[model samples]
Target: MSYITGFLTPVKTENKERYIESARKSWPLFQGYGATAQIENWGVDVPDGKVTSFPMAVKLEDGEAVVFSWLVWPDKKTADDAWARMQEDPAMANMDMPFDGKRMMWGGFETIFQN
Candidate 1:
């Protein structure tokens, strides 16, 4: 089983490009530390349900788009270590976070199925 850390957030319309650029800049930092990250832009027709139905979780005052992202690690321990390093890295310091942490929702999910 692979350890996974999930980050789901609604990007501010005005800051979308800036946010993505910031994320792109930070991508290598994560890869260098032994983790893989994948970012997904939600579809307009995303259904409202247990996972996709996070209407209340969105932060934008008046927006319908959401960005769902996840980072995959070799295992939980490695993921934990990478995140710890990321916190201390100067490159990650003072970087503008793409999404508002307050408005975002995230969690670590155990891998149940993968093909």
Candidate 2:
């Protein structure tokens, strides 16, 4: 099964370009560490909910948008190794995030199905 890491974050609407640039800069590290694929989705048609929703999940604020992203690895071992390496890589040590890290959410999953 493929290993996937998913991320949900709230980013300033005005920082979209900065965010994309950050992703572009970080892609090589992921590729070198065995990530097979990566996707970054900007929120469109996202709605606010009284109870819960994507926006609420990240505590979306004015002039902010939700970003859904994921990275796929060949297997858990490769993903694990990549994560460990990222922590030690100088390339990532000062990587600037265009959004608030405190509000970002992420997790790893073992993909059970894919087209």
Best by lDDT: 2
- Give per-residue lDDT, candidate 1, residue 36: 66
**How many residue pairs clash in each candidate at the backbone level?**
1, 0
Whole-model lDDT values for every prediction: 0.74, 0.94
**Cα lDDT for residue 104, candidate 2:** 95
Tens digits of per-residue lDDT for model 2, 8-105: 99999999999999999889889999998989999998999999999999999999999999999999999999999899999899897899989999
List candidate 2 segments past 4 Å from native: none
TM-score of each: 0.82, 0.96
lDDT of 1 by residue, 1-115 (tens): 7888887787767777887787787778888998766565653665556654655566445654577778888888888888888888888887878676777887878788999
Best by TM-score: 2
